[model samples]
Target chain A: MKGSLSDSTKRVMDIKNRKWLIAGGVVGLFLLASKLLQAVELTLPRVPLADGVDVAIEWATINLAPFFDGIKLVVIKLLVAITAFFDWVPWIVWVVAVGGAAFRWLGIRTAVFFLAGLLTIVSVGLWDHAMSTIALVSTSMVLILVTGIPIGIMASRNDRFESALRPVLDAMQTMPSFVYLIPVIFLLGSGKVPAVLATMIYATPPAIRLTNLALRQVSPEIKEAARSFGATPFQMLFKVELPLAVATIMAGVNQSLMMAISMVVIASLIGAGGLGNDVLFAMSRVRVGDGFEAGLAILVLAIVVDRSTQALGQRASKETRTE
Target chain B: MAQEGAPKLSVRGLWKVFGHESTGGIVPDEIANKSKEDMREDDGAVLALKDVSFDVNEGETFVVMGLSGSGKSTLVRTLVRLIEPSYGQIIVDGDDILQYSEKELVDFRRRKTSMVFQHFGLLPHRSVLENAAWGLEVQNIPKAKRLQIARETLDLVGLSGWEDYRPGALSGGMQQRVGLARAIAADADILLMDEPFSGLDPLIRRDMQGELIRLQEHLHKTLIFITHDLAEALKLGTHIAIMRDGVVIQIGTGEEILEAPADDYVAEFVQDVRRTTVVTVRTIMDQPDLKLRQSTTPAVAMREMGQAGVVSAFVCDEEDHYLGMVSFNGAAEAKQRGDATIADAITVDEYPTLPADTSVESALPVVLEHHNEGALAVTDEEGVLVGTLLPSSVVGAMAQEAQDATDHREASAASLEASHADDQEEADGDGDSEAVDPREGMEVS
Candidate 1:
């Protein structure tokens, strides 16, 4: 009597129509809510919390220093050691390593940037200093990864832990670079230790935040499936959850590396040695040419580290996708 | 072969509550303290599972059929202690598994059971072989032995050559097969499947269902399958448990459940069951008992039909092969017109003949489509007439069966209530005189 169609066809049509309406409503509601929220925020008067209660920045910086310093020292030492090993091997080894990394990450053109950048540093007689800087960033990244991942996992599992850590992460991400120096200068005192400490504090938030987010984003269905198969909590974490979140964690590492390099230059103001010190010294004497040279050297160092780490992250993702 | 002993798995009085306002968190108030109407309205504390109990007989396909959020998945999970029940006892082979510690639970999972999920849950980073071997490896089986077993299992599921491909490289159906292969390789006694074929295309789903049936026929492993598809339940389940909300509404054999549904919900579920696909010809066939006459001429054909007391006759050639049919009217018309040859006038391939092995269910469609007046002839492979099924007879048989089913349901419900009232009378200590069956009083229906 009705439209003599199959029941399944009708069901599918109904589902599609429902999905379309839902999508439209979601978008419209999101725009309207944002507009309303913005208006409310603009109309509301601003008020500051009690002066002593504003401990977000202070606590974040204080907690961040030791971790950052530990990272910087590890990076510098590793870089120096790697460079010394490379110096003994044939120049072709360097070519191959950079070439392989370049091809993997940003492709051939960026690989050229990588090669040219390295060559320029060598040509300018700043290879050793560049290696030390490279070492500092790598070491910082390693420490950050080791510490941040566990904290992230914990935060993801416990809602209270995550909520408690939120303000600290926010403050670490937003605090001025110069403000990081005030506390580290008082506790660790100006030098490589303070500078490393400062860089760690500046660079750790992204890693922690990303790790937490990645772990949280893992599909509940996947976890339930794993559990039903009799995976112990620990086994589930290592074998299922961590492996699934590998790509996001790698991206977090890339962010951390970028942050560390930016901090390295700022750390130079606290009397930490490297291209930062080189540029700072050049600037203090009104020597524009020397300062420009040192600045270029820092740029070269940043590009090499950024490309290599990014390439590593890309490789991890590619391997994951293939599986 | 049915084992004469206790079931392989048994659950008793399982309860899981969430968001309860309590400090110690040790006990839950009895559901009877609240009325059915109040329970439906109150959303404060969600009761995921409430006094759910069942026994999974060894080597039998016990299906838990329920819609999403009906606690079927939760029930399965709790049996394995994936989500701990607030109050319950699970006896696996007569051992109270609910008392098992963490390590003991791990040991139980490793040795006693394996699960297949709706989403397949194959490790995305591992090859098919590696993924299949994961469960064995977790139990510390030697890599070589595990891989060898994994290979055999994959071959069993028709994925022998794709062992090196990751789950991402395979289609959804193949991935599910791989998941199945993984569970089989674990060599667990009980296999728990939670809507394992729900995410596949209809054709693939049917194929997988057939594959599972074939596998079960060979292996005869204990299976507790959960699905929302009524058709799948009827096809695979030796016994089906229909659940609603957080409780099982009915548990019985497929035929029993279909013949006499427990309630309005189950009745509604089976309302659209296409009888054409479910009934068989054996249920409707009648034995042939009539005199036969050899007639080649139109006048002889009329005489034979008049003597047989039937509407139609199966025509045959000299070799005894089926030709078609000759109706009484046709024979009489030819005789009156002075047709000399009955063979020349008889209709060839005029009658629709179905095989004896075919279900009355499948034949209903063929009969309806062709608009046949009466029974279609049944034939053998050699095209010899075996029997005939009338359209009127099938319709009449089906209507009678439906009526009987309804009557049976009502009788069963009355008996169930009577037994429940006796139990309540025994439990009454203060002589309140209010009898109630805890199960009947449950809000599931």
Candidate 2:
């Protein structure tokens, strides 16, 4: 009986070996066939996918000219207003306000870190560029929030919508950030509006994904308890689900801010003026010192924004958490 | 719309089959008729609740008791339509809730029923007061009024000072108190508690059980409680339904189930229950062997006691209000001393009197302290003498229960053996063989 078991196993091994032999034979036959056909050049006719995309973009540019102009005008006005506001405020006042907020929510150490980071930007003679970059990132974040949060909420509620959204988010995150510039420049033209529009496309996925994940992660018992109490769907979402998920959603917002900051240099390639413009100018001329200065200022901004948003997320969670 | 004397909540022919189909889908007759195990194994479906029906009277605590997977939880959830049943009627105050629209169902839940979860399903983000007010909050009550009501309910549940604290800060027992306060603040007529204390420590669980009993004393709400603990079921339930394999095996009071179980399964289920804690004196009390009137002389009481072959006698007034126990020897001593009446002979202060409704466990100490007299007076709520209880009698009743259970089990096994013999004969018949006479081959053992 022992030998019988081993014999059956041996038979199984023989079958596996035969299967591999057959696979190798098929591969060899394909290779031999290809060698035999080498005399004739065989090629597939290319699909006109690139041409089709170009035609679609051309059609949208011509037919949706008014719609694109309306969006561009709104973006220009918002950018001008925000840039003017930053110009109007003294650098010290901006620093003090941010530093005071950091002190209040995060503590003295974080406050000192924020003050040092801001003063470094001013000391390096990149204060104007830094302010402009802040303005652009702020505007992009506003657009992202307005669009991303609602989409996230809808995805959380509907399974089919969530499934459909998953692949689109995957594509948005995984595709090269540079690719978004072409479509925006083609539609909205080359300026701050296109830059802002490009940043919106690149940075919005995290906000939608994190918000959906947070809402979906709320405990089933809590949801059932809410429902058993006869809460209308609206009440359940507002009173129970959103309140619990606010911390994680704030985390999504933080991710969006970081993504917007990272997009600043990329945004400058399309003639959007900011710290990104300084860095891009230095790269074209090969001025290492100027590029390093601009890069340093961007780094300081990213760190301060990241830490501040993180602190905000932490504060939200603390407010909801039991002591 | 409530009809005259309609039950507060009535569930009829409720069926919940999971993994069968989507909502409002009918289970095929072939699938429905198969046993739960077979359906799960062969059809990739679960019979969560099968043909379950029960009525909860107003102010009665109806306990659904089962081990895990017996579908008691599913049954309770179906009552509120939290888990929609495949087929059922849930009539609440004479209106079928199964037929309600979404709005009407929400209205019914807000006004009528509130559930307490075993896991204390409190909003961790909300303070205790806010959590308690949640049911009302969803109903859109004003904040001030709801908070006031919540504060009062917290006080009722002994959590007054902890109103502002979050649920996570509290211990398991205190958290469940918050759960209770939440349900109470709803002021719903029907409170559904799904194994509410099953997650607590044993000591804390006992305290919570006592707390619920205390609340129910004043609240008198219609409670449908689910529990796997038999002791908890017997202690809390006014009427209990025992479920197994998604089917109810029996429904009766604790004493009725203890005394004459409907089937062998119930008999076996109740075998481990300690009768001394569950059986009340009312169930085990007997008519006194001898009784003496206060006006009767000691000589007359002694003669009555001797004639009745009892060592002790209960003395009562002309209206049968219990006086005290008068021992035969004491009466004899009084007669020899030429006392005027049996009043002096009656040992009133030494013997302990028990209320007829008190459990034997509660009366055990007093019974033991006065076991010399061998009997104690049992009286109704109004102090009218009803019957007598003996310490020996309690032990005898408990012993009799154990004997009866054993006898019942033996009888059941014998019957099972007889049925198996019949089955064997049928199998033998399939082979075209002569059917052996069952009695001749049956072993006596």
Candidate 3:
């Protein structure tokens, strides 16, 4: 009796005593790393693989060019097509999508703000450009999720691979968005493709990092319960782990979408036309009214994507808890 | 009911080792070169389950009782191939299940067995009915038919009207019942429950246990239940297997385990059992002596029974049919009522009655429920009393058994220590032995 404690009591005490300090340390480290990287645009010099590797570099760049160019053309063509289709569809569809999401997540007041934001953008005559911006953001998100989730799953499955990739992910996330354009432009040249490539590099870290974090955070008890009931490893991942990690991964997607949207204006430097191009053109021409209108359009687009994804994430988490 | 056939499930020499280096080196030369202990120690492996074996008979409640980390969970998991054993074979319905392919394993799981998890792994996105139909759906059953079956199963588990609610809206016990209903709906021959009631409150746990027993009585499915609680094991198990450190220490009927534990660990388990309820009249019944003088008076009956050192007197009719039982206190209380007629004065229905065939476990709940001093054993269907049981006698028998076990354990420990001391003394008598010679003035306290 003196030494005995019920299993649940011990488990509760263990949870209460869990090391939240480690989480704090990780956040502090991230902030410090970000500040340091920002303070010094530190770049490591690349050594050529051979004595006369200039020819190889040119050959490699030439070889990789067609693929990047093809990707660029496809992305821009898809964006233009989506924008044209948006003009045909009633504006009410966009409003409903945005408003419905807001109502689900943050209720009526937020839903009103969502409608008001869209109305403000359209009233300022940037509706077409905003729709174009939405196309770009959605495209980038779909691409990132497709690539990032598998990579995250691989990283979670292998400790050495995950550890090796951790610092690379951190560097990509912390480095300036401008740095992505340098290599992307060299490979694909200035276009929507280079712009999307840069945005993908900048926005992808959260998806991978959060996927890994969420999978690791799943309780061992839940996993054991699944296994005890004859769930195969694949079944455990698809049925239990994936469902449980849906909220966190969706949050990652939301962050990626926001980052992608933020990169659109920066991406305009390479002829990635959208509301970003309008904002850049208006600013350079010193047209304050035009710049404000484009800026408002971007803001509206950001809010719509952010709210909808947030709503979806909340619904997923709520469903998980109910199950 | 015991069936005259092979067991439904049989596991033999099962071993599950995690993180073992030698697992990949299964070549004959390598295995022959390495000793078992050397391989085990050098590989730094954890033997989650070791040389464990058990057979679960058809239509019987088989309980695997062990504390956490005792390999009870591991053993159960291996039965379903959830955690595949490194060695040993599992035979289900007389076929080796270890040879099953991926598709075959899935088929086996869906058709032959279904499991209830402790945490109630209901699909959160699905409604209760949908969750219940999950297993049937996995088997490729059509949606409409599966839903109908799921609804019926939900009704069976007492969730008939709550089909639309998700698992979160329900309480913990209700969720577990949903888990049970889902397993039952699968219509598998074997039901494997891994500590299903462990998470519920005590009252709910008892209710669920009762529900399981009731369901089992009607359906007669083979059940493999795992629990750490000895009380639950005794209550639910037709046969209990007590495990320790990845090994089954004992496997027998509940009475065999409680009455005759294999070792100290199991003795400690049953030490705190409520002996008055667990012990039965059949276990301590004395033969009837008809030659004794018949005293119908309550006061006379009390004196005669007390003098005879019996806890109760079995009253019989002229045809030797059991009429009723009168305990010493019942007779004494009757005398205090100031009624001269013995039939009017004596308290006839003071104790519960059961047939001799009733299990100690089944009788326990009845006795405890009624708060009866004892139970009477009857022979005929018309409640003909055969013998009387005293609560005090059951307690005395349990106390005596416990004392004997304790004394035996102490004696064994003493003998072991004495043998060790003797060995040390003999070693000290050697001339080359390093000995601390006692000083003449030193007291040998």
List all candidate RMSDs to the true structure. Answer: 16.7, 9.5, 15.2
Candidates in order, TM-scores: namely 0.69, 0.83, 0.72
Docking level of model 3: incorrect
* lDDT against the true structure, each candidate: 0.73, 0.85, 0.74
lDDT of 3 by residue, B318-429 (tens): 5555655666776778789865634543345555566654434344445555545444444535655565544444445656756765766666556534633453343223
Tell me the tens digit of each residue's lDDT in model 2 across B1-445.
8787888998887788887643433345775678878977886888888877888899999999876678888888888889888876888999988888899999999999999998788999989999999999998999999999999999999999999888989998899999999999999999999989877766667778778888999999999999876677888889999998788989999888877888876765566565666778888888988778888898888888888888888888899999888888988898899998998887788777788877766666678787876778899988889998988887787677568657766675566446445543432223221122211211111
User: A1-323 in candidate 1: lDDT tens per residue?
Assistant: 35555677799999999999999999999999998898564556656664443475567557877875665466557545654664466545765687677777578888787778777767767666666666566666666888888898999999999999999988988989796687667656677656666777889888888889988987787677666667788888988888878888888878888889887678888876777877788888989987887788888767777677666777666656633
Range of the 10 consecutive residues with the lowest summed lDDT in candidate 3 chain B: B436-445
lDDT of residue B226 for candidate 2? 95
Model 3 Cα shift for residue A227 (angstroms)? 5.6
Off by over 4 Å in 3: A1-57, A90-108, A157-161, A215-241, A282-293, B1-4, B21-41, B285-354, B359-445
Candidate 1 chain A: 10-residue stretch with minimal lDDT: A45-54
User: How accurate locally is residue B286 in candidate 3, as Cα lDDT from 0 to 100?
Assistant: 44
The superposed Cα distance between candidate 1 and the true structure at residue B80, in angstroms, equals: 1.6
Q: Write the per-residue lDDT of candidate 3 for residues A1-323, one digit (tens) a residue.
A: 64466777888777766766677789999999998888676688877656455565567578877776678787777666766777677677877886886787688999899899988877777777777777777777777998899888888788998999999998988998776666666778787777778788889988998898888877676565445444666777887789888998899888888889999899888767889999899989999988988887888788877877788898889887743
Q: Which ten residues in a row have the lowest lDDT in candidate 2 chain A?
A: A314-323
Query: What's model 2's lDDT at B351?
Result: 72
